[model samples]
Each structure stands twice: as C-alpha cells, then as structure tokens.
Target: MIGEARRALPLRTATSRLVVVVRAASAADYEPVLDVLVDAGIRSLELTLTTPGTIERLGSLIERYGADADVGVGTVVDREQLSRTIDAGAHYIVTPITSAELIEQSVTHGVPIIPGGLTPTELFASWSRGASAVKVFPASQVTPGYVKDLRGPFPGIQVVPSGGIDIDGAAEWLEAGAAAVSVGGPLLGDALRGGDLRALRARALRFVTACSQAPRAHRSAVPTRP
Candidate 1:
C-alpha cells in the first residue's frame, strides 16, 4: 500500500509538519489550490469530500501531483466514503470523529485514518483502535497548554491539532506537542473562494517555515510498573 508506507506518527508523514486542509466550492479548485501549496514546498494536502465532485478531483490529483504531494481526503464520516477514498488512491483519510467502523475499514483497505476527538477518553479510544493519529478538533476549545497536559497521560499517542488554527498558532501547537497542525480558513482565507493563488502560495510558505522551526515530539511512552 503506497499510503501505508507512512511513518508511525501520521504528521511525520508531512515534510512541512503541516497538513493544509482545503475546502472549496467545487472540484475546479483542486488543481490550482494544490499546485500552489505543493509548489510552495508544502506536500501534505487534505481535500475535504464536502466539495462537489470530490471523487473525480481526488483521482485526478492523485494521478497528477500524487508523486510529489501527499494528497488525501478529509471529512470522511462513513464507511462508504472510506471505500471511495481508498479506491480513488487517497494517500490518507481523515474523519471529524473517531469511528471504529471507519478505522476498521481503513485497516481493511490498507489506508491510514486520522480520527477526530475532544475529550481524553475519546482521543484514547481512537488511538487504541489503530488510528494513524488523533486530531484534537475544534482546537479553539483548548489551548496548546492542553496538548502539553495530554502528554502527561498519553505520552506515546500521536496527535494533530486541527480546526481554527491560525497563522501564528502552528508553532504553538508544535512546540506544545502536536505532531503536525491542520489549517484551513486561517491559511487559505478568500483564496479558497477563488481569490488569489500567489497569496495562498505565500501563506503556505509561511506555515511551512513556521512548522519547520518548532521542535517535534518523539514517539515514546511512559513505561508501566510491573
């Protein structure tokens, strides 16, 4: 499985230490948006299925930039979408919530799955199920401080903080403990609405540079007492 060859920590799969979440009005946005980000040296892209014509767009992107870019699908909520993403050659799959069935399907299909969660219990549940990584979602609800705290209990778990991550916040999350940061509107803004490619490219560069400086968390765990 080409996608299965990623590192144990999902975020480590990205050279930029950033997963740029792209949401667009339609399939027409895939090429330009992804091209700008990839050319800027950000290889990880999560194209949310919420966009129209995602199947075709995902396939096309995989055929075109799949060699250089780590292209995947986001907002996958059900098994059906999971199957479709795999068949389309998605490098990975991300869901807003942790679903055992989704995880199982990803396992069955041999693709990686990043499930979303809020509480410690939810996050742990996802991790225990073989998720590629756990996404602490709506990150606005918790600060980077929370990620540091989570380390105390779940030291070995790979985490990616998503939702509402701003330009200046990527380093904050990385420094605190995020394996990578997922950014959407804060990075793309109007460019996703057909605004400007060059500006989006610049923003992608800024984020890549920001994440590059933050120290990465190693995969380790607190050993249990025998």
Candidate 2:
C-alpha cells in the first residue's frame, strides 16, 4: 500500500509536501485558483465535492493539470463519489470520515485513500486497513504535540493534518511528523471570490517556501516495547 501510495502521491517531494485544498462556491473557480497555486509550486491539489459541478468537471481538470499537478477529489462520503473519482482518474481520494468500505474499495481500485479521523482509534483503524495515510481533521483543536503523542503508539502511522492549517502551522505540523499538511482558507483566502491573483500567488509561494524550509520529521519509527 505504501508503495502504491508513493506512486499515487509523492508526499516527500518539495512540491507536494503541502497539499492545497481547493474548496470554492463553484467548480468554475478552480482553474484560475489552481493556476496560481501550481504556478507557485504546489503539486498536490484537492478539489472537494462541496463545490457545485465538481464531479462533472473533474475529468477535464485532471486532463488539463494531470502532468503538472496531482488532481484529486476530497470531501468524499459515499461509494458513489468514490467510484466517480476513480473513474475520473483522480490521483487520490480524501474522505472527511473513516469508512472501512471506502478504504477497501479504494485499495481494490488502486487509488490511495486518505481518510480523516480525530481520535487515535479512528486514525489507527484507517491506517491498519490499508489507507495510504490518515488525515487528522480539525487540526486546530490539537497542537502538533498530538501528532507526536500518536507516534508513541502507532509508530508507523503517517498523518496529514487538515482544517485550519495556516502558513506557519503548515511547517509546524511537518516538523511535528505530519506526512503532509492540507491547507484551504489560509492558502486560498478570497482568491476564489474574485480576489487578486497576484496576492494569491505570493501567499502560495510563501507556503511553498515555508514547507521546504521546515525541518522534516524522521519518517522511520521503531516501536518501543512496553
């Protein structure tokens, strides 16, 4: 699964260490927003289903940005969305909650799934069942220390912190052992609302620089015997 995951999304790369979550009011807003983001060196992009017409437009978006960045679907909560994402050739699928069936289906389809969970049990279950990595949602609730504590028990688990991750928080999570940091509002700001593209580019670049400069946590973990 890890090998498949690496092929699906290279998290260790400077370009993909920060996943830009593109959630807008409409699917039409994605291209311009993604253009600035990709131009600023973001290689992993997640387009959520929360946006209108996302499923219908996903294939074209993937075709357009496939070579430069990994285009994926997020906020997936059911089998239908999961199946559609796979059919559209999404590089990956990210769900807001842990679902054993979803994880299994993704594995069967050869797509890496990043299932979200806040508690240790939920995260562990996702990882143990063949998830590429577990997403720690509502990252604002717990500090980076929470990730470190999780490592004490699940040494081999890889976590990606999502929800409310700011520029500085991105680096902090990486340093705290997150496999990747997912950013939305902080990175997108009002860009999707007809805001300045130049400002968006500048902010995206700053995030890219921060992730690159942050000291990466050692990925290999050896479990300690109690």
Candidate 3:
C-alpha cells in the first residue's frame, strides 16, 4: 500500500489543504479526539508519534477511520520510528526534521513522507530527496510573508505550515503559497482538554470554512478523505 501512496499523494494534497494535528493527551483521549474531527469533515489527519501509544494506536485508527480520512503519522524522527509507523498502516509519514535515513526508509517503502524543516537549506534538501512535502515548524513565530519569501528562492517546493495557526490564519498561509496549513493547539484548543464535542465540531467547521474560502488556486479544500 505504501508503494501506491506517492502516486496518489498529489491528488490527496490538492484536496486536503487543512491537515489537523492530532496529539493525544492520554491514551483515552485518542479515539474521541479523532471521532469529532473526522465527523466534522476533516480529511487530512496527522497522528503525532510523540504521543505515547500512537504507533500502537495507528493501526486501529487506520482500521476504523482509514476509509474516511488520510491517517498519517507525525513527529517521526528516525528510521526505527518510521518503520514502526509504516508497519502500523500509516498512509503518510511526517518528521520534525529532515533525515535522509528516515526519508530513504519511507521512499524505499514507497510511502509518502513530509519532513519538517525551517531553513531554506533543509527544505530544499528534503525536496531533492523526494519528500512528499516539507512541514514548516513554529509557523506561528513567523508571518505568512515568510513563506512567500521562502518561495522566492525555492518556488517549486511544497510547504505546509504546522504549529500555532488558528482558524483565521489558515487562509493567510494558503494565500501566501503554502501548499496546505497544518493546525493544532490553536485549532484543537480545548477539545483535547475535555471540551464539549459540539463546540469542537463548531470550531472544526470554522477552520474548514476558512480553508474552503481560500483561493482555489492555492489548493482545493475537499471535504472528503480518500
């Protein structure tokens, strides 16, 4: 299945411009955390490996919601972690830093991988290594213009902003040429902290709406997952 992921990635990216970061506060928080978002029409989902049992939980998620969303693993930093994630049926892999070994592991498996990077050198290196995309970490510390500036030198690289992005900031990132915007904390807000699912649903819709209204040239905010 990993072998087919790369071929299908572009289609996946074109439609999924709003990737939600799912970090479980506890093992018990995992399922409900995903249920509300998936039910809210989130198509692109990233389950961070930083959470305990995430690698173990990835399989069940892929089994239960794989049909409704793209269940990928994030914060993956090494070949061992990458291997475990792939074996757990991850549809895509994400790393917090560029790792040739990790990228090679993913590419060897034919699985789509998004490696994180902040500098131009790191981002371009990932692209040259056949990364599915580059995740721009700590995006909240910078403005959307930073992404535009990055594009000036490396115009063809695909970047997805991850971290500190709120619903309103989603569109600005997209408008600035980010292939997609990965949101957590701000978007997840009180959900993981035991907030009402109804309120979470409402917030999810707002993020979705903000993403949907961005210029179509940025990327199609498809409501469905593969």
Ranking by lDDT: 2, 1, 3
Model 1: per-residue Cα lDDT over 1-226, one tens digit each: 3223322533335456799888888978778788888888877888898999887777878888777778879999988888888998988888999788888778666677789999999987877777777899989899988776777887767788998998788898888878788999888878867788888888888888888988876657522111
Candidates ranked by TM-score, best first? Answer: 2, 1, 3
Model 2: weakest 10-residue lDDT segment is 2-11
lDDT of each: 0.79, 0.84, 0.78
Cand. 2 Cα-lDDT: 0.84
TM of each candidate vs. truth: 0.90, 0.92, 0.89
Residues 1-226 of candidate 2: C-alpha lDDT, one tens digit per residue: 4223322344433345888899999998889888888888888899999999999999899888888888888999999989988998888899999998998888778777889999999998888777877899989988988888998888767888998999989989998988789999998889999999999999999998998888878877522111
Candidate 2 — which residues are off by over 4 angstroms? 1-8, 11-15, 221-226
Which model, 1 or 3, shows the larger lDDT?
A: 1
Per TM-score, the best of the predicted structures is 2
Q: List the residue pairs that clash in candidate 1.
A: none
Please give, for residues 78-134, the per-residue lDDT of candidate 3 as tens digits. Answer: 778888888988988888998877877887787878888888888878766777778
RMSD to native, candidate 1: 4.4
